[model samples]
Target: MTGLGDSRHVVVVGASLAGTRTAQNLRALGHTGPITLIGAEAELPYDRPPLSKDLLVSDWSDETVEGFRLATSAELDDLNLDLRLGVAATALDPDTRQVTLADGASVDYDVLVIATGAAARPSPWRPASGLLQLRTLSDARAIAARLALREPVVVVGGGFIGTEIAAAAIKLGCPVTVVDPVAEPMTRIVGPEVAGSLVDLHRANGAATRFGVGVVDIRGEAGALTVVLDDGSELTASTAIVGIGSVPGTAWLEGSGLTLDNGVVTDARLRAIGVDDIYAIGDVARWPHPGLGAHRAEHWTNSSDQARFVAAAIAQDAVLEYSSTDYVWSDQYDWKVHTVGWRDPQGSSVLVGDLAADGRVAVVHADADGNACGAVTINWVRALNQARRLLMAGDTAEAIAEQLEQLTVRAA
Candidate 1:
């Protein structure tokens, strides 16, 4: 394996949050090596969470939503970091440590960080222009234009992205309907108990929630879109947004000989499992999670934490293991949802607080032997943090409930 750190060429692909942070941390670690940031998007790296929230509310200006621009043209000039935008990587030759761009140009690097991230998976059932996918700033901008028409909008997929966009459309005074195959939104992530609360949240906000249904087909004509559901129901609107899911952007690494499953397979250290001097992070990484004890591809906290860990490892020239705290956060309507660790409701679960009646609540998931597996919190950041610490301490369901009760008593 080639040594990293001093005078090495570190190339990071995908200029999203993870890629940008990797570059920033590399500099912070005092690595004087040449750094190159490559991105397929035309615009600079920006925050994606806000695209569904603030951008839809019309509160965020165009420039403000462009997210955190780590380095500007002048900043790049001063730092002498090569910032390549609007160029798609065509292939990767791990043996040669060379990245081939679409323009037939190749860049060699001593150390490579594959932060290619993930792309919005296009709907297989929809026509070329029948559905709109949300991922990039351009996608958001296009959807915004459609929402401005104030016509009825149907959002496919009831996950966080779909629900958030639906709420935003509701705020815009547009009649919005959400369709999903699952019985409740966010069931896969937060489980039915927590996801059911979200159903009520959307309903309370005057957005129609159609669960246990899927958009079988989409047909568009004359500047209008029609979405057909599995149950013979049809929804027509001027615009339709599809939030199905995303696939890892590792197409260029097809013949790289590095492990690739849902994402580029990497060890806990974020290094490609079988290749030296090659690493993967962000949404494009599939690593065995510390809490889950299984390989998973997560989009948010995983990326951030892995970037920091990999940066330090590259700088120190040592193999460092990355263990996730398994933290993921989401904002829906007036509720702030935070999840920590991995939770299975089939396991022992204690209703830490009153959830049936609502207000705010917390649910702690425990394993068969009573060890805390994870927790789901609604609008309860303080309690969530408490749960996180308690889980890390190997607390049980009863213990966590006691802690929650103590928190409630203190709040009173």
Candidate 2:
């Protein structure tokens, strides 16, 4: 791997976690090149995980929010990034290697890294004032204020964000109801076996569930909202938080000539397809995975991992193939759920421990070929670690479960 030289100017669009990390990694990897990090928001990059968990349930304060900052002022200065804040990239001209900003300014670069990430999908059923979606810091602040009211809350979509928001609402003593269009909304990600336990956990915590139903309409104003379900039932709540999912923030790249599926299509090396010296990372990159095929990972760890890999690739350091272990965790009530690799709901899953008795369970999933593809564990960190190691080694699902069981027994 050869370096891009000290004089090469690299422009990073999107001053997100991925964007900030990329700049830091480039400097750390001995790249003396000029680097510019641009973001649409005026504030510095902050950690988003707490937005769904701690930020929502806790008392609202600017100081409390500042605690989630990814880097302090001194750390940002050490990174030495040419920070462009409060402006967004309006367009991209890959041919000219220039990015057009909203302020009628264009930044030319020898290398470009797109880390625009993703935005929360807006709910089709929009009410006057109570409808909300959590993506940015402002959104979290608004939701936190609403939760502090201790009013009835309806959260649409039972995905990770939706569930976590429900958990937060529960903590605030709010009457919360989570609605999803599937019998088990997170089954595709955590498998039906483990997902069932999650559903039960939420139910036990006093969060009502309305699965297999969709939101047809939202009526009324801020303090009084009626959420009409597909089954002709109406749920009355003071506020509604829609956490359906996220879509790639690739609208600005409409005519950028780069291939865009769900995101900017990239090779295994994180380089944009058919584009020279252009890369995409984080939620905005749909990269090829060796085992999972083409996939876009929206997890926080994925963004950081991709940023580190792309930085090394750009700096011409050790060129290693990018392969993600695909890790994600969720904190719901007292349970800490963790998953590794990919879980297919339709795939065969073998349970290793009792989920009902101890809330410590591991579900090892296997593909059609009987190869361990993924695993989900609840309050069982050791089992999850063991499954990850075995899965990476291409162990069979049976073998992984057997080993996990033995480890559990030995510990007992």
Q: TM-score: which candidate is best?
A: 2
Overall lDDT per candidate, in order of appearance: 0.81, 0.89
List candidate 2 segments past 4 Å from native: none
Across 131-186, the per-residue lDDT of candidate 2 in tens digits comes to: 99999988998998898899999999999999999999999889999999998888
Assess the local accuracy of residue 124 in candidate 1 as a C-alpha lDDT between 0 and 100: 71
**Compared to the true structure, candidate 1 yields what TM-score?**
0.94
Candidate 1 lDDT tens digits, 212-305? 9877888874257778889998888777788888898989889888889988988777889977699999899888776455465555787888
Each prediction's TM-score versus the true structure: 0.94, 0.97
Model 2, residue 15: distance off in Å is 1.0
